[model samples]
Target: MPGRLLWTLAAVMLAAGLVAVGLGLRGPAGPPQPPAWAATARPVAHHAPVMARSVPVRVDVPSLGVRAPLVRLGLEPDGSVQVPAADRPGEAGWYDGGPTPGERGPAVLLGHVDSAKGAAVFYELGRLRPGHRIEVGRADGRVAVFTVESVERVPKDRFPTRRMYGPIGHAGLRLVTCGGSFDKDRRSYQDNIIVYASQTAVR
Candidate 1:
């Protein structure tokens, strides 16, 4: 709860690992200005209760038609987050070191914008807007439904490490992927697509 402790955790999360960068991705102009999601049905409120710890089994974003099995991601020997392996069945990975999807803290999810052959899990990640729905099915059989609050594209050099991971007052979810122009020289995208959402409901 202390500010210093919060930032310490955030630093660990950032150093844990970044998402799997795609080989070739089509970058959008940039992240759109975030409008409030308050006008939408079931706007984010503090009424929702945080659930107990449980690993997520799958993730579904109906608006984007994204439904994929979830995989566990953790720190590597080098102290970085492990990249989702190509042979893995899941399209995206959950940062197991952090809180679960429905827990009273930020749940981090990572994915690639594209794969070597073609488009991957988060190919249309930039298209998501405020109020879009994100559902994470937990192993405990309960589903945590989150409503998108904002989406942004920032240069990888300036990724919001603390802002994205420090808060823990409520249940939150962060979906991250590569975006912006691909710097062929660097072999990665110039920016990162980050989706910030909060638990609005549960079942």
Candidate 2:
């Protein structure tokens, strides 16, 4: 699909807000513009050498002590990307429609921050800062190593779809989960936490 349309769909998904994590809480927050890495990040037009496509089977963040098997996720009836099954809140899901790990595009993953039971896969996502490492183990017996560049916590309404999903020449990964304040009445988070990283190696 054309990058433009693909990102538009992703934007729509973000706009709709992730399918609400856990249940019951109250508050609101959002990330600022011009991510910290903006000065160093290459512009979208400069094509980098991206790796061949491969199915990502696992994800790990050593610094945060996060590791999980990846399940494929597709769009919902309303066009929003589906979240992992609520019962399996500890799992993280990859957006099957976008680029695979190591491929030259944004590889999206979504996980719950917390479930009714307790902390979920990406509960510590907000604590991540630039320079952290994220690894994606692919089906072909290779792992794509990515270096964290920024972590953004933004309101659901101000979702930065362009920066998160827009055209890019190098392989990228986005870790997303509900964040900020929770609305007890709405039973949802008022914001989202997005971790941005770029593929730096294949092992």
Candidate 3:
């Protein structure tokens, strides 16, 4: 969202260069850009798991007075969501392949801790502690509640990708957002804070 234009340009440049090369042409053109999604040697599918089309009716965190709508989004080639810009900033979205909230697996929700401008919806997510409650209401009229178990901040360079996105032994929930100090050069947060929770109650 913050650098949408930059990403668009990179994608376009990469696509163009690939097309030219495949046509066996010589290019005295500008530097080639990285592909939008890298062209892997093996086939990879970006398709998300099909789930019942149920709207996120509500999200409630009494400690934060955070009761808001939830949206679903697919991951980018960078493995992160294209966070909504200013108008609908702070909104959270689900990673489709990850588990659903009330089901038996890890459900992931991602939000922007802050945008290029300022604090975003999940700016205070790091403050939550074990035992704090998170409730999600579904369009099907089902409400699921999860209890926080831990909160951790890890550097982006060493982000625990597998632990955060890997298979889980039980029905779990994770809330992720940018944290730690901001990086001026990178124009992004230096760390990512995650909140781990598990299914406690459902209605």
Candidate 4:
């Protein structure tokens, strides 16, 4: 219910052009700072290394019951990350400017918490727990299996740019959606829910 309450209001603003697409990807000024917990958070740990050069086709999070097709998203004219079409809020968008899932960096997957009508793809994203598995199917026929490390609820104004979109020593994943409470006057969610995960397996 909290997710829905925050998601719908943000969705309404996103539909109305009040909220920027992939608002958390880029800050108005500079690069993002890695979250405080980054040092303790282990990268996706596994045996041999695999090069992730393929594009993502879909993302499946069994714990949250999420399986959504992926769309390639680029930056806007002002250099902000682009999001899926507002009309199609259920879709998830992969940031093409960054490494693909299973790659040696933080691959971004963004979705609307809710749509204009109701709950969207990532409505229950905040419910995911550490160690949850997130499977991302790639265009190259491999599934990048990631293990969740942590989840944080941060204010939109203080989104960690470096910790989130920054380069990592190993394959990583970031699942982002609007969270916190909705501000009626602002017509948007005041916080963001970010899931931090690491690539642990490939198949």
lDDT of 1 by residue, 1-203 (tens): 57897676656655532433555544444323223342232436757889999999899999989899888988777656665665542489898878999999889988777765467787778888888899999999999999987787767777687767776689999988777777776677777778889998999
All-Cα superposition RMSD per candidate = 3.8, 4.3, 14.9, 10.5
Instruction: Give the per-residue lDDT of model 4 (tens digit) for 104-186.
Output: 88888888766565667777777776778999999989898889888777777766766776556888899887766566556
- Cα lDDT, all candidates: 0.76, 0.75, 0.57, 0.71
Candidate 4, overall lDDT?
0.71
Runs off by more than 4 Å, candidate 2? 1-11, 15-18, 21-49
Q: What's each prediction's TM-score?
A: 0.85, 0.84, 0.68, 0.79
C-alpha positional error of residue 154 in candidate 3 after TM-score superposition, expressed in Å = 0.3
Model 2 scores what on Cα lDDT? 0.75
- Put down candidate 2 lDDT per residue, 31-106, tens digits, no spaces: 1223444324332222335778888899999988988999999888777778887778678999898899889888
Q: How are the candidates ranked when ordered by lDDT, highest leading?
A: 1, 2, 4, 3
RMSD of 1: 3.8
Off by over 4 Å in 4: 1-44
Candidate 3's displacement at residue 179, Å, is 0.6
RMSD of 3: 14.9
lDDT of 3: 0.57
lDDT of 3 by residue, 40-82 (tens): 1121121222234355556788887776677775544754444
Query: Model 3, which residues run further than 4 Å from truth?
Result: 1-55, 77-80
Which 10 consecutive positions of candidate 3 have the poorest summed lDDT? 17-26
